[model samples]
Target: MLTPTTASPRLKLATAPLMLLIGGFVSLQSLINGELASRLGTGLRASVAAAVSSFGSGLVLLTLFVLLHPGSRRQVATLGRRLREGTLPPWMVIGGLAGGLFVASQGITTPTLGVALFIVCVVAGQSVMALVVDHRGWGPSGQTAVSAPRLFGAVLAVAAAVLVGLQAGLDPAGAGLGLLLALLPLVAGAGTSVQQGLNGRVAAQVGPWATTWNNFVVGTTGLLVFWLVTFALPGQLTAPPRDWWLYTGGLFGIAFIALSTVMVRIHGVLVLGLWAVAGQVIAAVVIDLVVAPEQLGVLSFVAAGLTLVGVVGAMTLRARGVR
Candidate 1:
């Protein structure tokens, strides 16, 4: 088996494009899941169904792939042995719960918030927490100090979120509820940093695919129970839609999660967050323009530019600092 690369401060330029691609997958997943929710049920029931469908489908797919791969099977056994020996902390494997929270939040709020607004809110939360994750050495790449460039980059990312939020122009009558639902994605966004950190740790031991499978296992199980309690008990459930596109959220999610599992170790939490957020902002902006051109504004485009600047500045400045 190939040994995992050690987390290093040196920038790996080759990985930048892949990180951006993964970020685009995130926004795409939200759009797909939100559409699924709209077609499936109402209120929280729709959210639960969307979340369960995405995670459950991904879990099934990953389970089959892992079971079929001999190397992955050995890795799973090794992970179990490490757990028994107390070499790997049990808490490290629970990162999927964080991913599940983000997914559930997307399902609940994305239809109402729209992809661009929802993604910016997530970027707001993620950019802040990623700084904390890196500074505290919680991520797999180890401690990355809160340097001026890093801090400024985070501020820029958050500022971009604020710009998008201002442009969103929520309805006056529904502003209160809108604000409340927006907060859910904000909190869920923060959890993504934690999720990436933990998953990166696990991925370093096994492979990205195996780590992703484990995430699906834990996330799908948790979402299933949440759906049972909240939607199933209240009799809010509805039959899932037959549309093939509605189910593509899981495939997009798997791509992003697996890619992120690898990228987090290379870029560290904060830089990775910025890069992903940059890509997410661009994708979200394009999507909003296509889907709801009436809502597009100068500020939205400006926010996207700022996000790109922030990501580039963060990576370049950090690399310079390291050198």
Candidate 2:
């Protein structure tokens, strides 16, 4: 029942607050994807639908904006031209696959692990990878050394995950499977970290709007193909309940992707990961409480607070330009 609408989306226009708000979207996205996964746990309907909604809605809005702003259209043209001339790395174009991986993994993991734990593990992965990625100068932000403070921050993030796992009281019977499923988001996080860097580079070439549009094109194509393949399996496609909130994932997806495209360029991957994780953990706690208050407890709150502390610690180091 959720089809792409014609209305343009209201984007976060300011560059400064984009990073902060994107955090909110990060948690929101996870919750939405988790619900979508639950609805289609028997099959792939939820993942596919979520992906399509994300890409289709974002593309439609982007197209409208580009048409109205000649400057934006020109930027898209420039990116195309540059790609044709081999000025940009061809790999940059595939950055959207990261989004595909994210939604797909959520479909598999979130229902089991819950959003708070899922996000904590994701932060662990992002913290480690972003440290390496930023340290190696793989992204446009240049090299940031993995100093003591940065290393400590990564340790804290890992600790946060451990705390959540402990609080969940992982059942020994299902521990293996639960841990395995939970780890899937770590893979998603790696994809996202790389995707952030690639999109950042592309943003330099075509501007943020076009960079996000390109991500939608590639990511949506991939998801749509997978969605079609799901029909071949034995499961039935389950439509989500008529709750309007279930359908808002795509909008949040667009917002965060666009925000990350810009944030990676400005703050680098590590900073973005830390800050975004802070947002995700905090938002996730509140969302979980609202969704199923009985499922959460004080330990969840502790995990969230720990994540913020780690993020703030890393941010302080970055602010000081610590070598």
**Highest lDDT, which number?**
1
TM-score of each: 0.87, 0.83
Model 1: lDDT to the true structure: 0.79
Q: After aligning candidate 1 to the native by TM-score, how far in Å is the CA of 237 from where it should be?
A: 3.5
Candidate 1 wrongly placed segments (more than 4 Å)? 1-16, 164-170, 232-235, 261-272, 294-299, 319-323
Residues 52-87 of candidate 1 have per-residue lDDT tens digits of: 999998888888888999888888778788889988
Candidate 2 regions off by >4 Å?
1-19, 163-169, 259-273, 297-302, 319-321
Model 2 Cα RMSD, Å?
Answer: 7.0
Model 2, span 42-155: residue lDDT tens = 756665666566566767777787889888888889889998999987887898888787877776677767777778777777777767777777676677667766677778
